[model samples]
Target: MKRLKYIMWYTGLLAISACSSERIAPDGETEQNIDVHLAAGISESDNSSRSDNNTYIKTAFTTNDEIRLVNTVFFNTPDFTNENTIFTYAGIENNKYKFTQSSQNDTSGNPDGTGSTDDTQPIGITWNDFSPTSFVYMFEAVYYPGNELFSSVPSDQSNVENFKKADLLIAHHRMPLEDRYKDIELTFHHAFAMVKVEATVPTGVGGLPKNAIQEASMINVQTAYHVDYTATIQNNGLRTVKGIEDENYPRTNVKMWLQSITENTAKKTQTYTFLGIIPVPNPNDPNEPIIVQDDFIHFEVKVDDKTTKTYRFVPKENAIHLEQAHITVLKLQLGKNGVLPLLLSAEIAPWTQASAGMILDEEDPTDNTLSGGNSSDDQQGGNQSENQQGGTEP
Candidate 1:
């Protein structure tokens, strides 16, 4: 209904009819300050916690972009004319960081004495200044502020074509405007699912010339990636929303090209690559908890400008969660013969946590043997590479 209404409006069918509406705003001294804090959470099974999850120059570095806060009402009904939303500063500090800004006696300063704690905020919210009824706020880290939840893809933006990528993410959190003037901890779940593709051709694939496997480009992958929420205010003052990515609806018109992450120029072997993170709405039924499930992940791999192999995988069971930038890896082994019966396996993991995320099962040293498996290691995902190095999961 949300999407349809927008389409009608854009097509010049729906126009505002005469209606009287009530508008309210917070008044002087009605505000109270609340501190915001963040905590890093990842799946236990996610080994790519802080390592191979695309760190600076390395894998796994802290996010430095400032976080954005919007009035909950704005997302439910976006109105630039609505002055209800306010942000404290240029940007919130990156995760596990401290506020470097000079402190002021203003209530926006740290209510709790500033400490070098990861995600502990020195700032407070001037709560009373905002709309008393507009209690909930939307927290997210998008490419830019003022991005529409279900808007169209700009021609110049990354997701518009195969050349650029769109990683814009928004984790809609509707927190109650509580009277408690203390620290309020909010968890920003990922509104987008990470789709990582690890495609491999056996050592001696007969179908292609040697140079063909050296370079591969992803032509395009299509899906309905944009979404919106119609939240219901809960008893706890928190709003519960069902995130819908109706594939049957018109395409979000979003496209993605595979990002080659493990192309070894030295060995001339194309191992693995990433399919940039595009929006995939949480398909959870409002009644049940949010668990991303049954979404079709599809892709077409073109090697050396030829041998385009297309594959689709729908997670049979619970898939990767749309949380904290976690990712679900789909490994497609396009057989040595480059024929039908593609061997594919799925693995769910968090970014920056898994060490062997791109490491193929056949090439993984953790394997006890080929054509055979170990029960213990199998349960551990068959790769103890991180364990062997005495590495810790962040």
Candidate 2:
């Protein structure tokens, strides 16, 4: 068994340490500059075990990963807006994850063994004409693949590589800026729900062959998602995941990609696991019950090398409700009784960061006008997995 991997694209803590100083401006006015030092990786808090071996699998951030920070500094001023700050993960140095400002003009001074061999430096965040004791009320952290924050969610996420990029994570926080030397830990949460289906069958006496399963998928699922901070957003939760309104969005079939196949001879059953990521439902009331409608699990099985059969399973009402940052797992038993739901679990855990080896290595992601700079870095950590479900009408 390869162990359950790709639980989520990103789920971990990002520790940003800052040192403060005062620099005199050309007008002889004092300005506060905070030099950011990056020390980020997966902590022991996010851990999970394999069911068979009880071992752990860790995932980490890859080189060139760019994170965007949008802060709304609250002051007594009448006019106020948000400032977008960008940083790129530039490999490890001095046992700390080195991050550099994406700005091409920033050069590292190599102080305290913090600079990488590439001469990259952590960017300084400066506040001009304001008291260093000011406080920032709203801080938004967003990570999009290639470091590009798309105005809208992509219509397609079928490909694992594209899915990895589209696995958007966002975090919102209210922190005091009085402690300029304090480390700001931004914890990102997934903006979408994950659905994983496992199909199983007994191998003998009226049971199908081990190779019977051919393909599996979810039918009539929401394929597109759109989220924005411009709308009313809660302090901790993500903005409601609104489906992208387009001909290709809000409706499509998502093919469940196979992750692993395992056989338990002692149990006399073989299981096929397939997983897919879906957009969370958008309800008018946050507390209202989520109801799934007209959705179905469609599967194909080979009766023999020359014969194939198709089957579908419609979920009973109240069996599943999808929520952002949560995962639902559905298990089906293939037998003479048709496809029947065997095990259904919901919200086992919010989807977390990616497993090992899925990291992207490309650097210099295209600049979003909101922020800029370029660099890269890498790390090692594990993803938490759980025995973690869907319903459709046939």
Candidate 3:
């Protein structure tokens, strides 16, 4: 499923790039650019706000050009069990039996193997008693500028301005599996989290020439407020289980709702939403599960320098579940120079029921009887007479 998601994401990115308008540089002006630096753990002043005992992580991107940033933040806990590799079986004579053949190869003798082939043999099979072991989260950031200023190394002035306008913040404790395991008769819980962008701004200065006079300029601007989001996963199952791989395990769904809160009573409250889902398909697999798309919710508010906006998001519903994997993405966009304080909060709930065919064999045997065997004949011939006659029952 992970492979499929990558293909989708890659294709989406390519499409975005292809569709984007090309920006031509001027005769001699160098394009501006942006660079990001990430710091793990929170500062001492912000330590009190950390939840789930999680450490704070920081990311800063500086650029010389005016670029539209495309930040893709992914929280992925690694599955050390190597569950990303799809396994299949082959050469089956009946639905109940099949030969174990590695589906890790193909007719061309390439690494691409035949996935779920029913005719060649029932190919895909999974163990019924496996559990997750470990988890890892991945975060990605992409920045695109509308003009050529960001095409290359930005001027000093642009770099300083970009740094000043960049958003610096952290996401608190938000788990992916708070709801799915709530009612399951299991004892283990899946806890996952990461900090993400809170808000952003733009520096007022333009690009600076290499030989420009050096002046003491107050260029650095600190983030105005601190916010944290948190969630906890409890062990509800009977036995202790590790985290599952992206393929074998279920997708974790996250929902975030934001509301505006401030003294500027013009707009007392406005809501913004964010959703995250996981376990997307592997594009290479012919029989791979369908892609699980991430849903991103964005909110935009306009305010003057005299007014300030406060925003908060909270989770409303349970995390959705599916028989297969999927992805969800959310984004909140606010204009620059808007003195609004963004407040974000989230809640996670797991799906209640599994998709069709997810359950193990649960048929009732008492209702089924052989049609042609001796036992069937005995039943048709009133074989109960033997037992009634005190004959040895076999």
- The CA-based lDDT of model 1 is what? 0.37
TM-score of 1: 0.45
lDDT score at residue 374, model 1, on the 0-100 scale: 22
- TM-score per prediction, in order, is 0.45, 0.60, 0.16
Top-down TM-score ranking: 2, 1, 3
TM-score of candidate 2 relative to the true fold = 0.60
lDDT of each: 0.37, 0.48, 0.23
* lDDT of model 1 at position 262: 56
Of the two candidates 2 and 3, the one with more favorable TM-score, higher being better, is: 2
Quick one: best lDDT, which candidate?
2
Candidate 3 lDDT tens digits, 304-341: 33322212221222122221111122222222222222
lDDT (Cα, tens digit) per residue for candidate 2, span 140-188: 5666665665644443444455445555666665556565534444556
